[model samples]
Target: MIADARRAVVRAGVAIGIGMGGFVDGILFHQILQIHNMLSARIPPDTLVGAKVNMVWDGVFHAFVWGVTALGVALLWRARGGSARVPGRMFGGALLLGWGSFNLIEGVIDHHLLALHHVVERLGPSVWDWVFLVSGVALAATGWMLTRQIDS
Candidate 1:
């Protein structure tokens, strides 16, 4: 019983970490850096006229991401019988890595080809975009590897 509780805690912590990491990324890039939000492209011209609309949408998006992540953690906890098993850890790690990869690739393609705002709009756009991509990949990989080690 105690072991089960401990495992549940660990899984929840891992989920929180991943979700918080994602939140930080969104806050830093979308808010502080003034980069494009998830749906920046869909906005009609001269609607909000500035970053206000983007900020609102970004907040909502981050909220949803956080919710989903928390739900994922709950599901994992239930599915694995509240144990930090090797498979659970690997699955969580892979999820983080996949999300990071998607962000990196999408950011690059959108900024470079689609003319969307860079990862950090204030930082000369393209350069910061690449930097963001690399950093995201690094973070995700590190999380994945560390989780794998924990599982092992």
Candidate 2:
């Protein structure tokens, strides 16, 4: 029925929004910031011998992140019962907020304090990295708050 269709669309939109937030984190940090890639594994510089090995692992890691995000979206869709619910929204938001917070803290500790990587290496990386993290947290908090409103 038309109502069902509308519900389905709404649910899908919520899932997509959350998933897109995750995708943006991965893309901006892994690609644009160039601080780190999706994978935890590190790749040696291209000047190093066997650099190709690192490249291969990097590609695999990025693919894994993409797959995980897709799976998460699918799971959210199922859990929300074709409709966005308070619990689902809150939980998803919390999860993403945690992830962003972790990244922000870790990046500061490892890259800034530890000097493992420059804050801006060749270009300005830290600025956008923080922005991405903050945006993610905001989205998650909004989702959580929306979930609460629906619940009440």
Candidate 3:
């Protein structure tokens, strides 16, 4: 049987992964880099007013990321009452899984299906998007393999 501690650790890892991933996307692409906004691809937030609109979307996105982080912390806190020993591999693998899963699902649904945004806006469904998806697959696969090697 999988101990609650292990389960909690995995969940916590996933949460952290998701939160970190979101922050990476938001900070690297959205704010610091300013390569793309949440709706820049769709709405083309070029003007001051448009940028304000995109900022709102960005804020919403950050809020969601914050929530993911909070959930992860809660999971970790719960684990404190349990066995307290969580395998490093399990946690690491779960982190990769969660982050990769986010990229894969978000890329497919938002970029491809919903036409929300692309990895590179000016490129317009170029190689960068595929690279993003492939990277996610690679990370997730590696993580899954690592987890499988362990006894869960």
Best by lDDT: 3
lDDT of residue 92 for candidate 3:
85
TM-score of each: 0.57, 0.46, 0.90
Ranking by TM-score: 3, 1, 2
Per-model RMSD to reference:
5.8, 7.2, 2.0
Candidate 3: tens digits of C-alpha lDDT, residues 81-152: 655566778878888988888788877877788877788777777787788889789878887777666654
Better of 1 and 3 by TM-score: 3
Query: By the TM-score metric, which is better: model 1 or model 2?
Result: 1
lDDT of 1 by residue, 57-130 (tens): 67776886688578757756675663455355555665665456546655667666674555644443557677
Candidate 2 lDDT, tens digit per residue, 103-122?
Answer: 45545654455543433444
Say what the RMSD of model 3 is: 2.0
True-structure lDDT of candidate 2: 0.49
TM-score of 3: 0.90
